[model samples]
Target chain A: MAGLTDNANAGAGRTVISVDAMGSDRGPATVVAGIDRSARKNPDIGFILHGPRDELERLVERRKSLRDRCEIRHAPDVVSMEDKPSQVARNGKGTSMWSALESVREGEADVCVSCGNTGALMMLSVLRLRKLPGVNRPAIAVLWPARSEQEFNIMLDVGADIRADENDLLQYALMGASYARNGMEIAHPRVGLLNVGTEEHKGRAELKLAHDLIAENAENANFDFVGFVEGSDIPGDTADVIVTDGFTGNIAIKTGEGTAKLIGALLREAFKFSPLSRLAALLALTSLRRLNKRIDPRRVNGGVFLGLNGTVVKSHGSADATGVSAAVKLAFKLGRSSFSEKLAARVASAVRVPQDDETSADSNGTTK
Target chain B: MAGLTDNANAGAGRTVISVDAMGSDRGPATVVAGIDRSARKNPDIGFILHGPRDELERLVERRKSLRDRCEIRHAPDVVSMEDKPSQVARNGKGTSMWSALESVREGEADVCVSCGNTGALMMLSVLRLRKLPGVNRPAIAVLWPARSEQEFNIMLDVGADIRADENDLLQYALMGASYARNGMEIAHPRVGLLNVGTEEHKGRAELKLAHDLIAENAENANFDFVGFVEGSDIPGDTADVIVTDGFTGNIAIKTGEGTAKLIGALLREAFKFSPLSRLAALLALTSLRRLNKRIDPRRVNGGVFLGLNGTVVKSHGSADATGVSAAVKLAFKLGRSSFSEKLAARVASAVRVPQDDETSADSNGTTK
Candidate 1:
């Protein structure tokens, strides 16, 4: 991909977000309209939108606020959702995804946001920004609707990779804690290692080692390391940050989403069971709307990638303008706080424990 | 522990279920009461109740139905919920769990039911009944609430052990399919191997190997083997039997349970949010009751231990009379159908694919 030069005319204090305006299910028009929405709401933010120049310009021209706040970078190629990550990494030159991330690499944008393929996005980010010095693997952090007043708990390594060693888990703890502190403004986020049981001796060998390692560094990591937590604690108030390998984390997340949707459908069916029940549902419309708003998946649509040198926020592929705007808003917040830099530092500082030490003690046993 | 000896007095046509009448949170009274409830509804069923002779006799005397249907076997010890499996294995003699399972081993009962510590029950079951010949690992199967009119999907290895190789997974498929066929009465039930994705290339290495083995054995196993399934399919109707490693299966089950409870609580809070909404709640009470009954965990509370020489049903530790009765009902159904013999045949037939093939090929590659 041709590098989009940094915005030389922009003021030093201004924040510019790079957006990959292609590959989303809603198409480029919706992506541009979403940028328009964000731009209108916050005049202080600017964008370097990556896509075909004529197509993006037409959409941006439809909104005066977006045209004024956005600068288009022409990249003719697009990464389709079905494209394999390996295929994209090797031959994805001039694609909008590569260009958008390039802007971040070249210091043209403070953050990068895309509503494209998740695996492809992660691959691109790792290929472009690279893992932070001490980080062995990157992780994806998601916000789950939780029981606390905050209404959200952060879970990490959702699908970055299917594996995590003991040291990787410790790094996820520190990185997730840092994200929670910066993103959620929690002073000292409580971190829990997800396990089969709360008992110390339960689960696989690595979880045990990870449990001990997290506890050992809890003070320096600036988080409370709750010994162990079960899957039920994911949406509970027992922990603010839940850490697990991507494979288990991904399964838990999908299972939770599937269960929620099933219940919601069942609830709707119940409300429509009879004329009297329909009347009751009509009467409870306001309360039901309030409840729906609280549990809406679209409201928490972005999964931020951590452990990379740059911040990349991945919106749901099927996100509408509202969801796209939400992702943009998250990217803007992290950009303002320099979240990527802080996360890199947090991971690097926690890497003082040598990886060889694990091999020497032969404590590197895995669940497999 | 003294053997209760074979029940020479058992009627030729009756199905006997050994019941551990102690250790449940509701105590022996509830166990006897549950028996009374089942006896009133199921005339063909008889029970061999295990507990202290005096305490159980008093409870049984309260119900004339239970007095005639139950045979008391004095077991003065109980397995506490906190007892470790290893500890229980060595010194579990004279305990109600032990005697209840022993009844099955001795052919005094067709099946055994207990509402005690799960780990302890599993330990006792394995020690007394032993794994079926040709079976390498035992599994626990639970019925999940599903989209099918059947109202449930059977999932296995909920937490039997934290590991399963390709052969073990293939065994789970056959065992779980046999369960669905005999217990749920689904002829040629569809079996699915749970993974992170539906794509053939998407998950762990063992999953891929297991996938091939299941597909290869589907016809002989007497089930249609779907290629791959995600966590979402657990509640969907895509597959009748979902099989995975114990680690993933355990996490998914607990996550689903926790998510269901969380949503239920949130819905209640929503209904009580305001006076007007509270009025709506009162009007919707009947529909809500119907909805609650459909999703009630108590209605489907038993976890059937598979691959064992005898069928053992583990009810929830905190099960009340209703939950215990549900478990007893399941036990009765399985006992009446001679489920153990059918499952053992199914597993033994599938075991013709030798465990040594996997060891020689070293196809034990895991996702990690």
Candidate 2:
């Protein structure tokens, strides 16, 4: 056990990264390629790829140098994409994704990045790493697809916490603001609550209440409150931070994601329509490449599950090598940042110990 | 008042649409163009161009046939995009948008369309139309950008009814299903609850509970239960009908909207960047065109605010003449169909009598 674990700890000292080799669209090949590519980019980092030993061995056969820089930790079972997080966590003893998460939990890895069932990864991380004491829920804080000067909006509650109230939203605002300040390393991050309209009274009762709470909190709020933002602001970089409930935030983020894919599909078709359009597309080539790079989802691959005790980054489940590589780099940057521990402790201290809305554990917490 | 009202209802027999002659983006010219185009396309439908009579008349001077088809209703005030709904609704006497809505409320016109402040429009509509007796909330149901065999997915609570519960979600599901069935004229619309995952254990407690309610209701539920769908599914047509709380549904729809814009921008850049890429784009043009048609947001320009007593279709705020025309056509189709009356009655009847989940105007009812 010691020998095996030690081998897994080859990631020690160097920014040790544990990749869920079995996770994602292309599996270990992509993960391995990404890890190797990223390792080459940053010589200071090493990795432990968690998956079936035979598969990793086969993929790594020709990559001898990469093998030296990385080690494989055998995780016998593979948790599937469709498995229930709780069910998987409860029964998944040696699943690759599980072991990758366990590596971080046990301090064997400095950062854990996985392109697996995001919710499952989240559940496992919470069960193993423990939630920061005060924060009731961990949110999925993301970079709002903004175009404004403050392009780095840290929008939160993208489904990690479901029934968030005014206080929960405040925590979200604070956590997101902290991330903007620390993660993006922006100073005096500007925060806005995502509303239907710019008016304070424009949203639902909770949004109104949250608006008031946020407004009052903003007087003493850790970050700068830039008032409210609308859906259009998500991509406009209207503010450095945007906050909303997990349900709304999740929908908004995914909508952005799916839309991006849809547009890509559309543009390809648009160019094929007529020779004139074809000429126009050809003529506009230079500017288009820059635009493509600007919106490349792969460039910003890892989405952090904020308010956790440590760094737990989720890459796209269907990510290719570029996306996984970006996730690795992101995890590295976040793992070494003081924001994780500082914000975790601050959030723990800052969290208002309000009464739980409902004591009865939601039996219907899962979707059928 | 009687004389003015009589003049207003002069075209009652004609399919005259009251258009808010104000442009949300580049000002009134675009709106005028849109209305003129609508009047031209649907000769059977008349146009009530509501705005500054002078500006509208001035804009209408050139179009000989459009001048006759679209008569200006002469509204003095315009609703600013930034104004609060509560304030704006009260402050505006005969704002073009307000006046247009009034036409619908008064039944002076068959329908009205606005590319104005959606918040104000919703508020005014609810105030004027009054929600159905059993209806606690109204929702905006729109077509998703994803490709579907059904051609589109109906998503509700776009931005209205933000803080919704299980009952509200259930109503949304039923209404969305009905809209798909009647509005799109599909049969046995597949209803899906949008969530983080499809597993029974995946969404928020309310959704999980809703899923069970839907599944249970499924045994007797009016629509086909397609279970839970993720963000990706919205674009994939995973279900014919997708239901969620207003808050989430709004964000999801908007995210898709903004993201499509962002990606469109990216693809334009990609096709223009270099020579080889440009040629490749030319080759890929055919596929791109097919993709565009598949995801044309304008093709389904109007989003029906379901659960309303009448078909109230909201077009994209920046919709031009073609979009508004499409919306009018949609409203007419819905109005003519047994959709609104039948759907409302079905949903109202189909709703579980809230045994223990008495989420009605009365929630104090005892649980089983």
Highest lDDT among the candidates is held by which one? 1
- Give the Cα error of residue A212 in candidate 2, in Å: 6.2
TM-scores vs. true structure, each candidate: 0.93, 0.80
lDDT of 1 at A206: 98
For the candidates in turn, chain A alone yields TM-scores of 0.92, 0.87
Expressed as tens digits, the lDDT of each residue in A1-368 for candidate 1 is: 12122234432456789999999998999898887888889867889889998887777776767644677888999999899999999998889999999999998898999998888899999999999998998999999988965788999889899999999999899999998888888889999999888999899999999998898777666789887988898888999999999999998998898888888888899999999889889888888888888877677778999988899999999988888988888888888888888888777766775333343225432211
TM-score evaluated only on chain B, model 1:
0.93
Candidate 1 residue lDDT tens string, B36-84: 8988998898889899888777677767665456788889999988889
Model 2, A151-244: lDDT tens digits are 4456787888666887788778878877776667777778889887676656777777877666654533356777778776788666878888
Q: DockQ numbers for every candidate? A: 0.66, 0.33
Best by TM-score: 1
> lDDT of each prediction vs. the true structure?
0.85, 0.72
Lowest-lDDT window of 10 residues in candidate 1 chain A?
A1-10
Local lDDT at A266 for model 2: 59
RMSD of each: 5.6, 8.0
Clashes of 2: 31
